[model samples]
Target: MSTTNTDVLVVGAGPTGLLLAGDLATAGIDVTLVERRPHGLGNMTRAFGVHARTLEQLDARGLADELLATGTTLTTARLFGRLDLDLTRLPTRFNHLLVTPQYEVERLLERRAVDAGVTFRYGTELRGLRQDAEGVTAELTDPEGTPLTLRARYLVGTDGHRSSVRTALGLPFPGHSVIRSIVLADVRLAEEPADVFSVNGSGDTFAFLAPFGDGWYRVMGWTRTRQVADSEPVDLDEIREIARKALGTDYGMHDPRWISRFHSDERQAPAYRVGRAFLAGDAAHVHSPAGGQGMNTGLQDAANLSWKLTAALRGTAPDPEALLDSYQSERHPVGAMVLRSSGAIVRLAMAHTPLTRATRSLAAHLVNAIPPASARAMGMLSGIDIAYAPAPGTGRPSGRRAPDARLREGRLYELLRQGEFVLIAPGGPAPALPSTAPVTAKHLIRATWTDPAKRTAVLVRPDGYVHWTSN
Candidate 1:
């Protein structure tokens, strides 16, 4: 057996792992990313919507423009077949959700990682891992089926559901299956609908369709009556019948490129971190794809963890263990919330009883009629209103996402591409920062502060969250 050492080991080269690897490599860390599959994307795409906040995060890395160019932007999101979440009103450059395939997102992140010198080993599988106080030892097999060993100070599992890393750590994925044997197909529509995106349900069936910005469209349909084994083969007629029953018509769907069936579960791991290893993305949580949040949540997880890991490894973190521990505390609740919201959407969509339908209809009307309710729904789905609590004894407004604003120098996010904390003070030199600041801080230009009345200082984290604000 041969042994290789790296500062950090990332398992699973999906969006989550790719983002984390890219960020870590950019911060000058020796990170290694391993994937079980070869270096290429399949035609199938599970996620299609890139919400506002995810675009913001990617914009900070200078990767959003290219991705946006490859997709179509839809400013409205219909919820529950009645209420609409107006995405255009969201306070961001990307006020609309970019409807594109998951591969587009993965491609941008992969390019960044490759440019940043991140080592990628394709066709490799992790057999097992053993972690102790010192570090983690990973047993792996390469493309040639040769046994290899890897040692790292920390390991992160961004693998999807049925994660090997989670299994090795014995993390219990506790939750039940929400929907079973749903049909997915990528095909061409001879008759395009008026709306670029649509979701509708009738009786015991649900269906959704969204364009891929190309000639193809993704069709997702589910019928309670058609429940079958995942191994069971599916044909175009079954998909058309389900769509016609759920959405009134199949919209002349034909020329199937690929078809498959999958089951969704609402599961969360007991803990995201265990000793020297951590779980993220689908490995940490799995939920119904009601809000198109599955991939977005994982990408955000990578953004949050990448800086914390980099700080710990570079000896810049004031309290390394606490910074690392915050990963689970901050993201686990978000995961639970995603499961709850997405589950609610799934249950409501699958509602068959008259009473349930009536109740759902009433709620939808209320949401549509109320402005505040509508705004909150859009913010939650777009992830703009995500916040955390103030850090203890910091006397600063912490745990809130720092909104992007223009300064004399440049945009707030554009300044963040250097991968350091940005501290904005009213005037003079930068104010004294908290001793427990997790990363190196860069002082913002005085012009960055819009208000002159308050001379307080605000510290923004590397991930663009407010670390502390002195008032």
Candidate 2:
């Protein structure tokens, strides 16, 4: 057996893990990322839509523009039925969503992590773990089947829904499957639609098609009238036929990149942390794919925890215990809200009753009539409205991410690029905190175009949320 040590050991190299690793490394923390899969990026487009909040986080890391180039920018998203609601009224620079595959986002983050010197060990599986008061010891198996032992002060489980770390801690993942089965396919369409996304609900079935680049479209719909037997295999031809019927077109489907059968299961772990180990991303919660919030939510989870963990490791602030508890206090309720909202979307769209359809159509019309109300609703769906409560005993602003502003040096996205605790001091010189203070400080003589002068100084976490501010 071989032995290694690190400040933090992360399990799973997916979006959550990679984002966390990048943040940690950029903050000068020693991080080790281990994955069972040999390849770093998976060959599947599980998620497609990067929302406003996520783009804000990525912009801090200076990767948003590159990502936007690979995919199409969607200024409008409409819900299909007798009536439609346009999503363009949402208030954000990224008010328009970017329709890029999940793999591309992962690849970009991985590159950033690697550049930051994050140690990534592919083909390494976490077999078991034991925690003491001081730290955690993880048992891992390498690609050649050699056993290796690692010690770390903390461990994070970004290992997806069936997380070994969460399971080993005996946490309860409680939820029920709302829908029996759904079929999703990624294929090239013979004729692409001018609209980026389309939804049609006419009968017992509803279908959604989102077109990406190169004539590729993601087609999703419910299985028809026959109750799906557990033993029956999902038919790709049937999925395409559903598209043809709902879309009212006989577009040829060819060269599928990925085919999947999914169920709308709404589950969340009872607790996010146990001892020295913590759960994040899909490991902590999962919901229906209705609002396309899965990957974005997970990425936000990583962003929220990274700065707190970095602060704790540096001993720049108070007790680490309080910092860890804040993660659950802030993210758990948000996850629950997402689960409820997405479940409602799925149920509303799949409703078969005439009264239900009428109600939905009326609701859509109402939302369209009131632009502000529609914008607020779309902000929630797009995750642009996330704001975490302040840590206990810290007189900080609660429930809003800090706006990205240009620095005095005229550098764009400068505050986010540092990946450290930043203090925006306007109308005064920067506060002189002790060098040993856990956070880094930056002084701006005056506020920039984005950051307004509401106060003397503003303290931002690595995730770009305003933690503390002064007037």
Candidate 3:
């Protein structure tokens, strides 16, 4: 067996792995990405909604604008027929959800990664892995069933739910299926949906409709009266009937491009990091598709973990283990939150009993009528208000996301394209960052605020979160 080595071994070539690999390569880190499938993206998409925070993250990478051009935007998300989350009012440059196919995201990320020199091993599958204090060793089978070994300073599993990497690490994805025998239909609706995004449920069924541009629609339907195994052949008529029951119409859906049946589960790994190996994306957490958050959450996960891994491998981190451990500490809670929110939405949509039905209605009206409540819900749903706690013994306000603060030369996100920490000083020229700060000289970019703002200087992490605020 031939053995190869790299700084990072990224398992899976999906959106999460591609983004993470691209970020590392952009930072000049060596990355080797392994995928079980072939070298081309199949004409399918599992994720259709890209949240504002994800677009912002892509903006930092200089890819968001191009991606935005490939999709339609939904400014308002209507759920349960009454509750509406106004995405337009979100406090970010991208104030709407981009209804694009997941494959489009992968294409951009893969191109970036290739340009940055990421080594890709498509048609390769991970059989198992072993990690020690030094690094991780992956046992893989190549395109021709030839066994190979790969060594890396660190490993990340962005592979989906039945993750091989997580299994090798002995981590448990603990959760049960939330909905069974769900059907997905890709069709051209003769009549467009009234809302750009639509979701509703009656006692007997639930339906969600979102566009993928070009008059194409992705419709997901579930029927309480008929539950069967995933292998059961999907009847398009059955799906349309369920949609009509829940949504009051199927919008004249016909000529299905494709249709499939599957089940959705709400699960999260107990731990994200185990030794030198880590879990991310669906490998770490998964939930019902109520909020259209699956791919968006995975993209954010890649963004958060990418830089930390870079710092650790670059020898710029003050404490590599602690910095690496932060991946779990910072992201685990966010995963739990997603699980709870998505779970609540799906369960509410599936409400059948009189008590549950009333609770669902009241909850919808309450969130709908209250401004603050609506704001919070939108914030969480859009991935705009995720904040980390202050690190222990530190009062530096280190965990909140810094707004795209303006600078004399350009925007904050534009500066972040260099894959470095951004130091924003109050007006005038940015002062030289001191040696005392926790970043290496090569990994810090200096800029001056466009306006005379706070007296305290701010350090933004590579992932766009505040690292610290200094006087």
Candidate 4:
């Protein structure tokens, strides 16, 4: 047996875990990341689309260019039998959607975390944990199955749906089984599709298709019958058949790379935090993969919790516990909303009734006709609609997500790349921040003032939400 100590012990090296580890390490915290798998990127493409908000977060970390290079840019997301929503009109430099395989995302994040001095123990699994008032003691097993004990001030679970840390903590993950099983394949197509994204809601079966790269397309949809068991095996021929039926044409699916079937389940942990141990990403919340929000949401959760934990550990905040509670309070509602929205979308898109289909079509048409309403509706799917409630004693706008804007001297996101809390005052010098403060603070020159006399100052958290402000 061996013993080790660190400020934070993060379980799982997936997107959420890697992002959080990078954040903690960049903040100068001692972080150790453990993964059950060996030192190789997983081939499975669990998620592909990274939204605008997530791009802003990554840009703040100086990783936007690398990620953009690895993925293809998507400007339009069209609904079958309906108008296409041009994402370029959205208010960010990353107005377009980035379609990169999940493995690529993990690889980029892992490299960044390693460069930041994060200790990664691949092929090591978290066995159990016990938390006291002072810190958390975790039991881990090495690749050779050797036992060890590790201690940390905080333990974070970025593990997947079947999280050992969450199970050991006795947290309840209450949700229903996936009713519809859909096939996902990553393969090079002989012929490429014209549209970047296409949705087919004309038949009893609904299909969604998106082209990734190298002539590869991701096809997802539900069958008319719910007889397909979630765990049942799927094949390439069946997937091709579904694509043909949904697209109303036959396309060759000859060269297959990987094939798998997945069901969408909506589940969230009862509470994000239990004592000194906490949860983030899929370990904290799981929802249907509609609108491609699963990975983006998890990444954002890591971004939010990282800074708060850093502040607490560095003694910049009043109490670590105070900042910890905000995690549950702020994220729980967002998770619930995502679950509700995704579930509704699945139902509407997979509806079998003619009347329901007609109604949905009409609704889509009406929304697309009105540009403002259409933009707002599309924003929900893009994750730009999320807004955190204001902190106490801070008179700020509610339900408005933090916007990425340009400052007179530098880009707003450039300041955030340092992985520190940023204070953006859009007129002149920022308020007198604590000189010896633990958190990173910066002043910005505003190009245009929202309020000429107010001298608006917005304090953005690591997750890019406006946590504090002065008007």
Candidate 5:
């Protein structure tokens, strides 16, 4: 039984933990990641839609283009069999949603984490965790039941919904199951959709179809007539029946490669942080899979918390509690919002009753009629419009996302690959916070606008949010 110490201990090697650990390691902080599963990217995956904001985050890390190459992109998304959520007009470099599996994302992030020197301990399970005024101690056991101890200044539980770390913290996950007996399948479609993601279902049944960019389509459907358990055996005939009812056709789906049954739940931990241990990803919140927001939300959580932890570890932030507390203040509300929005989407799609279906119709018509409303809806779903509440008198720019800008020498996201605070001054100097000089500022990058005539300087956080503006 040996003990280890690091600056941060990240439980779970999922997307959230991988990104957080990579970001920390890139910032020159020591991070150790532990997982119960073996070190391999397994094939079972359902999460596929990667939103624009997530691509922006990945772009900042220099992995977005690589990820894009591995997936298909849908410029427009149809909802409720009619209304369209256009993604082409989003004000970002990566606008459309990239449809790729969760495993593909994990593969890239894991590679980045490894390259950044994150210590990984696979087949290690967290049994218990405790935190004091100084730090957290995590008790672990290997596959052979050998005990190991880990101590870190900060610990994060990105271990997901059935999180052992969250359980160890004594936090209550309060929510109800949203949908049941939803079937997922990967098969060769005799007829592929004209648009990459147009197959949608509404009425007494619900179904969705999208390509996996490998000649296979991921089909999801549910029905009232054949409600079943997650562990129950399922066949293609049942799936085809539900798809026919919901989608009008099954697109001649055959030769099933993988099939599974799952139930969606809407749950959120009472608190994200208890002392030095924090929860992210599915550990903090989870909702229905209607809007494809689960993995995207988790990745954004990693981006938001990574820099704050770095600031705290380096003793660079003046108010460490406020800085760390801001993670909860900023992200928890967003989590709640996603829960409501995604729940609504799933419920609308899964509407089996006439009254609920009528409400869905009316809601769809309302959004379709109002252009601004539709834009806002897509913005929220895409995570581009998400923002923290600014301090009083800071105005609109303080809490919003800083759009990727073209600098005189390069691009803002290109510069962000260094994982630092970026100062965009329109032909001006970085103000005196620590130091105005970029060369001297350890993790701060100073740049000028491509158009030298412009004159507003915005300081962007490492996670691409507006820290403050020089007005």
Candidate 6:
């Protein structure tokens, strides 16, 4: 029965919550982050690949170089049996995928949040939440089982798939389990493969293995014949055999450090925001791990939601209602798209029907043979091709992600580190806007506009998406 007050309350200290907390704290807002677990970072992680656009977001925040140093970079990603999505010619500075554990991402974001003086409440559970006209009230239980109350202008839920906050709001997570009884193990391979990632599956078995930058590797396998309770023990020999059945060779796999089992589902919340409470990360949507986009998509959600929340709570935005509503309008579709794409990949990989198997094989061969089709596939998987459709009556290029380019002073991303809107005026002196304008004006930047012939100014959001362009 004690009470606390803050500008923003973020539930769940996973990658999503950590990144949002860091962004808000860096913007000089009072943020309180609560985690059910006592510790912040863990050694075990399920995600490994950081896609290109995510790397660009981290680079804008000045955290990408450190991460790049700690992980392995590969310019090519194999997809759908024989098809390959090459990132070497992608249009971003980080034209390759970074393979590292999810814990590394959490560590960096946590450091950023702590350095910004964000408050942390470990070993805490959210019992309930209620929202009114002014702010939100959160009911929490501490590690010692002491009940507490919190008041904040806004509350965000970044909890995992079974989110208490989402449940409290009476939202439905609509989807079904795509696969079950997936065997997961963290071990060291006797001989590492030359490829950064190896994945294969046929009939009823599927397997994949990726390195953690060090000598250790993470092996994942699923067999339709072995559907059992999650609590059932996983045998190392069975795992090796399944892996061998799917992949040509296990590459002398041995020395298991950790072993576990899981079931993957494709679920997404109907709505991201209800009143003052919002959902992000796994709480919002979850899909199959075929594209390694689960964690990356959640991180992107954090990047998208954080700035809007900051703008709304700080009362500096031009229209807080529109700004807040845009969160769901923009991210929900992306979530649906990821679910469909990943589900297709899983279905193709785990095909039991001869028709599906034949279709998958033909699609792979045709995509590989067509250069344009393969390039598009690479863009989608790498996240470099994501573009937001403009809101009604807005400019055509308003919602697209602003690509990084050279400026007169430095790089485009460098100027975005302050977590503010950037105005690009390249040709001559920048147009003078009112001091009360919601964007920051930067002149003489050698960046291109979507329509170079007529654009006098272009506006980029703090999260690197274009908001408006003057013609």
- Position 176, candidate 5: lDDT: 97
lDDT (C-alpha) at residue 408 in model 2: 70
- Candidates in order, TM-scores: namely 0.97, 0.92, 0.97, 0.92, 0.96, 0.94
- Judging by TM-score, tell me the better candidate of 5 and 6: 5
Candidate 4 Cα errors over 4 Å, as ranges:
398-400, 426-454
Predictions: Cα RMSD each: 1.6, 2.8, 1.6, 2.9, 2.1, 2.6
TM-score of the candidate numbered 6?
0.94
Compared with the true structure, model 1 gives a TM-score of: 0.97
Q: Model 6: residues >4 Å from true position, as ranges?
A: 40-43, 432-455
Tens digit per residue, CA lDDT, model 1, 1-471:
999999999999889999999999998999999999988847365888899999999999999999998888888877656867788889888898898989889988999999999999999999999988889999999999999999999999998998999999998999999999899998899898776566788749989888877888888899989888889999899999998998788989999988999899999998999999999999999999888999999999999999999889888877899989999889989889889988888888888899989878987898889988888878888888888766666664788888896755678898888777887777666677778777553323233576666677778887889888886
Put down candidate 2 lDDT per residue, 199-281, tens digits, no spaces.
67665777787877657888888745745744567666878777766667637777877777767689999888898888899
Collision pairs in model 3: none
Candidate 6 on 1-471: residue-level lDDT in tens?
Answer: 899999999999998999999999998899999999887445576788898989998988899999998888887777545767778978889998898888888889899999999999999999999899999999999999999999999999998999999999999999999989889888888877766575678868988877777888888899888999889999788789988888867878888888888888999999999989999999999989888899889988999998888878767667787778889999999999899988988888888798998988888888788988887877888778888877554568678888896665567788777777777775666666433244333311234444456556767788888877666
Give the candidates in order of TM-score, highest first: 3, 1, 5, 6, 4, 2
Clashing pairs in 2: 316-438, 387-399
- In candidate 2, how many Å is residue 305 off? 0.5
Candidate 1, residue 355: how far the Cα is off, in Å: 2.1
Q: Which 10 consecutive residues of model 3 have the lowest summed lDDT?
A: 429-438
Model 5 worst lDDT run, 10 consecutive residues = 431-440
Q: What is the lDDT of residue 203 in candidate 5?
A: 60
lDDT against the true structure, per candidate, is 0.87, 0.78, 0.89, 0.79, 0.87, 0.84
**For each candidate, how many residue pairs have backbone atoms clashing (under 3 Å)?**
1, 2, 0, 1, 0, 0
Worst 10 residues of 6 by lDDT: 436-445
Off by over 4 Å in 3: 41-43, 393-396, 427-437
Error of 2 at 388 (Å): 1.8
lDDT of 4 by residue, 77-122 (tens): 8765575788988877888888888887888898999999999899
